[model samples]
Target: MIAANNLSVNRGGRLILDQVSFQAKKGRMLGILGANGSGKTTLLKTVTGFYPYQAGSIEIDGKPLATLKPKERAQRMAVLSQDEHVSFDVPVYEAVALGRYAHQQGLFAVKGKTDDDIIRKAMEETGISDMAERSLLSLSGGEKQRVWLARALAQQPDSLLLDEPTNHLDLARQVALMEHLTKLLASRQLTVVCILHDINLASLYCDDVLLLKNGKVICQGETQSILTRGVLENIYGTAFHEWKEPVKGRKQFSVVTRV
Candidate 1:
């Protein structure tokens, strides 16, 4: 499990996050939601140790996140950021294999058959096996995103952090990725904390939801409880309409706007 207690962060003398507290348990996906500049990205970065916090603590599986060595941390957690860029042209296979570095004995360690198998499995799972030999630069935006996800999967971390993972994908691909994550959560028991702008997608896939407004957590709880039209309207300052799916009985919502 990953937990943040009274976490706070400041940048350029301005507070970005304030005393935010939440926990993502094993085998569950936690969706972080907010409007622009609500510190959604900042919270993810702080929990992953990319940004130093001014107060509070982050723990992973009962161990202080700060105390863990770099390799140790990488072995337990993996991050998939919004940007997917490669300075030089890199083969898809090579890019995904980078995740295994934490498990390597040394910088020059030779990759054995086990490493190859894991890479192959990751690529296959993400539906990029056929593109293994292609240059990452040649792939489309959605394809590149899938490759990045495959790389993170190859890491085989206990917890995965994703920032706007569905940004470049179409509706179909977006749903497919969420379904894949659901399988990963149930089969591998992977804990996921994802930053999402689409409230409907969060409602469909998230087991828990954390709503933030102006760097403060407005509410956090089961997805159904926290994502009511009132709470969403208060946080986004917009009107919303909600309805239930006739087949699944799941609640679906849409923003209401007048021309």
Candidate 2:
């Protein structure tokens, strides 16, 4: 299980995250929903040890996250940030192969058949096999995003942490990416923790939702329970409408007013 016990983070004398606690188990997908500046990114970074916390603890599979070596931690978890900047002019295939660095015996070790298989499979899963030879600087935003996701998948992580993984993608691509990721999570029993801006998408994809307001989790439960019109209206300060879908017979919620 991945867990945070009283996790807190302060930046430049300002408290960004405070006493936040949550848990995600294998086969579970946790969606974190919040408005801008609510510390969603900060939480993800802190959990992955990218940012230092002021207090509390983070653990993965009963081990302290801080105590784990860099390679040891990368073996268990992979993180996808909202924005990825690649300064190098590396080819896409070589970039994805970087994920195998942790599994390698040394810095200059050659990759074996297993590594090749993983890289190929990950590229295929993310639908980026054709772009494998393209340079990272030559691709569009969505394509670059998928390439990064493929790299993370190539790591063969037990858990994933994503910050708006589908941002800037078209509707079809967004749906396809989420479907692929959800399938991987279910089949591999991977724990997924993600920060999503679209509540509707989160409702459709995630098993559990954690609603945050001003850096604190206001409520958390099953997606269908916490994604009601009333809760969203209060949290986002907007008028909302909720109704059942005509075809699927599932609850459909939408924002109706700016205020």
Best by TM-score: 1
Scanning candidate 1 in windows of ten residues, the lowest lDDT window is: 243-252
TM per candidate comes to: 0.98, 0.96
Look at candidate 2 and tell me the lDDT of residue 142.
Answer: 92
The pairs that clash in candidate 2 are none
In the range 97-161, model 1's lDDT, one tens digit per residue, is 99888778977988889989999999999899999999999999999999999999999999999
Give candidate 2's error at residue 158 in angstroms: 0.4
Error of 2 at 72 (Å): 0.9
Q: Every model's Cα RMSD, please?
A: 0.9, 1.4
lDDT of each: 0.93, 0.88
**lDDT digits (tens) for residues 1-259 of candidate 2:** 7999888899999999989998987898899988888889999999988999989999999999988999999999999998688888889999899889879997689999999999999999999999989998999999988988999999999999999998978999988988887898889999999899988778778889888788788888888877888888777888878887665455667878654
